[model samples]
Structures are given as structure tokens and as C-alpha cells.
Target: MIRIKRIYEQLGDDDGYRILIDRLWPRGVSKENAHVDLWLKEIAPSTELRKWFGHDPEKWKEFGERYRKELSEEEEKEDLRRIKDLEKEHENVTLLYAGKDEVHTHALVLLEMINKKSS
Candidate 1:
């Protein structure tokens, strides 16, 4: 199974194979504390798109659309495939992100895409 959690959340044994999906490292979170198995920054939305969205609820729909288009690139496809591979190899995979607005984050869009593809 795949799960999404905030990077700042307390680490748990159930958070198997944690992967950090943010383009930028969250401020004040050290590597040791993060306990992340992989930092797949490439899977994150483009900086341009991120800045434009600015976590505004109004732009969420368009943000998802633009982010989906961004993920269609070859490099992003490879990264997404890697995530799928991890899910198969591990009992559970947790995607970690630093965004404050969980509902409007790229990680949510990425999760939807991944789950949609799997289904």
C-alpha cells in the first residue's frame, strides 16, 4: 500500500520505506530526524508551477492539471516507475512532503496519478 504523510510528522514503524517527494528540503528538518529512505525530488512539481500555485485553494484544479502534464515527461515517468517498483518491493510505501496544505499539494496529485494508474 502507498501512504502520504507530512515530513514533520513523528516517525513510526508503520511508515515503511519512507520517500521524501519535495523539491526543496523542509527547513529545520535534519536528515537524521527525517528517517527518509529516499529523497525523490525529481518527482515533485516544477519550481515554476510550485511558485505559481503558492498553495492557493483557488488554483488547485489547474495546479493538478499542470502538474500532471509535467509528470508526462520522460524523466518524471522514470521516477514514477521507480515509485511503483518500491510499492511492489515493500510492504508499505509512504510519500513524505513538506507542504502545509496537504489537500492542495503536489503529493496529493502524484498520489492520485499513481493510484489511478495502479487501478
Candidate 2:
């Protein structure tokens, strides 16, 4: 199963195979404290798209669609495949993001894509 979590949350043993999905490192977090097994920066939304979204609730739907398109690009295919591979290997794969608005974050969009692909 794949789960989305905030990078600032406390680490737990159940959060198997934590993957940091943000293009940039969180402002206050350190590598040691992150407890991330992998950092898939490439899977994140493009800088332009991120800037456009700005975590605005009004743009959430459009942001997800745009980000999904980004994920489907040729260069990003490998990253998606890698995530699928990790899903098969781990019982619980947690996707960690730094965004304060969890509902509007790229991680949620990515999680939906991953789930759709897996199903």
C-alpha cells in the first residue's frame, strides 16, 4: 500500500520505505532526521508548475492535472516505474512531502496516480 505523509511528522516503524517526493529539501529538515530511504526529486512537479500552484486551493484541480501530465512525460516514466518497483518490494511505501497543505500537495496527486496504475 502507498501512503502520503508530511515530512515534518515523526517517523514510525510502520512507515515502511519512506520516499521524499519534493524537488527541493524542506527548509528546516535535516537529512539524518528525515528517515527517508529514497529522495525522488525527479518525480516532483516542475518548478514552473509548483510556482503556479502555490498551494492555492482554487488551483488544486488544475495543478493535479498539470502535474499528472508532467509525470507522464518520457523522462518521468522511469521515476514512476521506480516507484512501482518499490511498491512491489515494500509492504508499505510512504511518500513524504514538505507542503503545509496536505490536501493540495503534489504528493496527493502522485498517490492517486500510483494507485490508479497499481489497480
Candidate 3:
């Protein structure tokens, strides 16, 4: 399963392989504090798409679709391929993001996509 978690959340045994999906490094979080196995900047939404969405509720649905499209591209697909390989190699995969609005962030959309592909 793919679980979405915030970078500030404490690391635990349950989080088998923590992967940060944000294109840019999170503020106030040192690399050592992140406790992530991998930082897949390639998997994040394109800069243009991310800026356009801006976390506005009205643009959320469209943002989800667009992000998925961005994910399906050749470059992002390579990242997805790596993630899938890791999922098969690990017990669990934790997707880490820095967004304060966890429920409405790109990580949730990435989790949904991962779940769909896995199922």
C-alpha cells in the first residue's frame, strides 16, 4: 500500500520506505531529519501545473487530473517504474510531502494513482 505522510511526522517502523515526492526541498527540514530513503523530485507535478493549481479548492479536481497526466509522461513514468519496483521490494511505501494541507495536496493524488496501479 502507498501511504501519504507529512515530512514533519516522526519516522516509525511502520513506515518501511519513506519517499519524498516534492520537487523542492521542504522548509525548516534538514536532510537528516527527513528520514527518507529516496527523494523523487521527478515524480512531482510540473512547475507550471503546480503553480496553476495553487491549492485552490475550485481547481482541485482539475489539478488531480492534470497531475496524473504529468505523472504518466515518460519522465514521470520512469519515476513511477522505480517506485513500483521499490513497492515490490519493500513491505510498505510511505509518500512524504511538505504541504500543510495534506488532504488536498499532490501527495494524496499520487497515493490514489499508486493504489489504482497496484490494485
Which candidate comes out best when scored by TM-score? 1
* Candidate 1 lDDT tens digits, 1-119: 89999999899888889999999999999998899999999889989999998889999999999999998898988888889999999979999999888778888899988887678
Candidate 3 lDDT over 57-108, as tens digits, reads 8999999999999888887767887888888899688999998996689998
lDDT of 1 at 69: 95
Task: Compare the candidates by lDDT and give the number of the best one.
Answer: 1
Comparing candidate 1 with candidate 2, which one achieves the higher TM-score? 1
Ranked candidates, highest TM-score first: 1, 2, 3
Better of 1 and 3 by TM-score: 1
What stretches of model 1 exceed 4 Å from their correct place?
Answer: none
**Candidate 2 at 63: error in angstroms?**
0.7
Question: Per lDDT, what order, best first?
Answer: 1, 2, 3
Q: For model 2, what is the alpha-carbon lDDT of residue 112?
A: 83
Better of 1 and 3 by lDDT: 1
The 10 consecutive residues of candidate 3 with the worst lDDT sum are 110-119
User: Which residue pairs overlap in candidate 1's backbone?
Assistant: none
Tens-digit lDDT track of model 2 for 1-119: 78999999999889999999999999899898899999999899999999998889999989989999998898787787788899789988899999898678899889888877777
